[model samples]
Target: MKSYKGRGVVLHTLKYGDSSLVAYLLTDVGGRRSYMVQGVRSRSGRGSKLALFQPMFPVEFEGLESSKQQMHRFREVRAAFPLQGLPFDVRKSTMALFMAEVLYRLVRESEPNEPLFDFVWGCVGALDAMQEGVANFHLWFLAHLSRFLGFCPGNDYVPGAWFDIREGLYTPVQPAHTGVMSRECSAILRDLMACDVRLLSDIGLNRSQRVEFLNAMLVYFGYHLDAISAVQSVRILREVF
Candidate 1:
């Protein structure tokens, strides 16, 4: 077996028997991969190791890799970034769950993508430290994430242009298909594309507006990546934010 060392963000995990876990992670060295963590769920203090596998938690690990096996085994693991607010705060934790689910669904490749990995790694830290405009963080994340996913929407918003989600562009004529955003929603998306993380607090939206835009963005994402069509954590995120 080949030895590997890298940083990763936990996407999700599943119980394996009574003493092990199957953890899925997006790693800097190997995009998305699964690891069979042994004895992490045992009733002894080893169970505490499960904390390292929380949704979107960043960790550095040394592991053994094999050409014939899909699930690797970790030799050692530890937190890469100690988050200050994400674990204890309800809103941040909920957002982390949604983000993790989205990544798990959409980032299915096992090939290394350094740029994408860096973006997600930075966003995790950003979310943890963010104080204001936390409600809008996920929207910002999804919009920018599309850029890495290769389907970022065009920011050409004129007064009456509709956003053709299926085509990923702005247009003056209404799209015949139902996968289109109204001019109002299109403008909001345009703002999201231009807005920076530091300026999120300035972009204001009520709960209803936020939910509508999030749903619209999800529709746009679905057109490009079919796997993200039904994100389960979105409901809980909406209620919390």
Candidate 2:
């Protein structure tokens, strides 16, 4: 088997039997793939390796690729960069869970997408380094991620205009569909779409407003992608932020 080196963002992992793990990661070289890592769950020294597979953790790995196998094997795995804050901070950690779950559910491609990989990798670093806009970070992430997912919202906002979630644009005339966002929520969404990730601190939302906007954005996402309507971490995220 040919060994390949790659960087990836850990999306999810599950225990395999009692002493191993099956990890799903979105890689720079192979897009999304599952790796069957042996003995990571053991009570001895290998248990520490489990930390490397946490949600949204970025890692560099050497793996053996086999055309015949659905689940690949990792020769070695280690963190790509040390995260200063994400794992220790409760709020950021919760947001990481939400981000990871959303990515796992929506990104199913096996082929590599360099632009998307770079965007996600950069965002993971951004999230770790971020300090001021912690509350709005996930919303910022989702807004930017939509560009990669092919349904980035239109930023043309006018007074009294509603956002047509189904159409992915701002409309002066109210959309008859239930997927339309009210003027207030539309204005917020417009701001979210227009703001850069570095400027997330400038956009402020109260808890209710944040929840409402997140629900609206998820609805917008759900309209375009199947099975994204129910992200399990969303409820926990709402309570945390």
Candidate 3:
């Protein structure tokens, strides 16, 4: 068996039998892969080395060539970043789970996108390093992801123009559709596309406004993404914000 090593972001994990784990990870070189981990339920399973469900780990794996579609096997794994406060902090942890779920849904298997991978890894690092006002991480991430996913809405919303949600374009005519945002919401969304991740917290939105913005983004995704559903994490995010 040939073996390989790379930095990976853990997408999700499931209990395998009683003492093992099946972890889904997105590695920089290998793309997405599933690896079985053994003896994780032992008394020594509480620390950094086997942080299977958490993102941002450097993984060493053995390559099994029996099948082209074979699942990757991990020989070792460890955290690349010491997440001091993210797991313990409620808001940060919620953001991480929400983002993880989003990535798990969005990233396709065997798709090699170095730029997108780097972007996601950077977001994880930013989430860990964030000191305050990290509530807007998901919103910013969604907006940035839209750009990469090729669903970036037109930033040409006029003062009196309505957003064309299905078309992903801005127009002067009022939308015949119900999902389209109002002129004010359209303008706010235009601002979102230009803001940096840190500045996202400075957008000065009320809870209602934030919800509207999120809904608008989801509507855009629904038009673009085939299997994307309503994000369940939005409710938790709203409650937190």
Candidate 4:
């Protein structure tokens, strides 16, 4: 067995039989890997501690030689970042679930992507530190995700030009009944692209505008990516925050 250690986030977790769990982890060094965690149902199990059910945890694992592509066995797992605030807040929890679902769907397993991994690690930290307006997390997350997925909004389009979601370019004519934001929406998006998660709460869109913008962004994602569903957390976020 070859052992490795690094920082990681729990992207998804599922029970295997009664006492064991299969966890999808996004590691800083290894990109994404699955680990078979034992005794997770027990209170004192290390699996319980190293799981992604909690945010911002450190992990150590050993890969088995029998199946090079199978889930690794975890040796040590612990929370590297103490989360005092994000878990307690409803908005933040909902937002976390949404992002987790998105990552679970999008991030590939066993690929080395340091930049995307670091972005997710930093995002979990920021979500923990957020004090107000947690709804803004989705905006920042989506914008950054676009950058990573190579569908980032373009800059060459004139202010009045329409955004072509399919082509990922700016156009003079909008498609019929397709996803298109207004000129004001484009300007706000440009502003959002320049800001980080912390700077988003004060970005100045009202509740409805935020919801509309979020819907448009999701549509933009669906236009580019396959099988991407409308995020469930969007409604909960609008209802609470």
Whole-model lDDT, candidate 4? 0.71
Top candidate when judged by lDDT against the true structure: 1
Query: What tens digits encode model 1's per-residue C-alpha lDDT throughout 172-193?
Result: 9998989998887888888888
TM-score result, candidate 3: 0.86
Ranked by TM-score, the better of candidates 2 and 4 is: 2
**What range of 10 consecutive residues in model 3 has the weakest lDDT sum?**
57-66
Q: What residue pairs clash in candidate 4, if any at all? A: none
Report residue 167 deviation for candidate 1 (angstroms): 1.6
lDDT per residue for candidate 3 within 58-123, as digits (tens), equals 344444423554666656565666776777788888887777767777777676678777887788
lDDT of candidates 1 onward, in order: 0.91, 0.89, 0.71, 0.71
The residue ranges of model 1 lying beyond 4 angstroms of the native Cα positions read none
Q: What ranges in model 3 sit over 4 Å off?
A: 44-52, 55-69, 154-157
lDDT tens digits, residue span 1-241, model 4: 7666677787678878877788777887677777787777776664354344442333444443235546677666656667767668777777777787677777775778888887888888788788765767777788788888778976565767777676776666776656677666666677777886777777877777778777778788888765457345556767865
Per-residue alpha-carbon lDDT of candidate 2 for residues 176-215, written as tens digits (9 for 90 to 100)? 8799988888888778778878888898789998898888
Scored against the true structure, residue 107 in model 4 reaches a CA lDDT of 72
lDDT of 4 at 157: 56
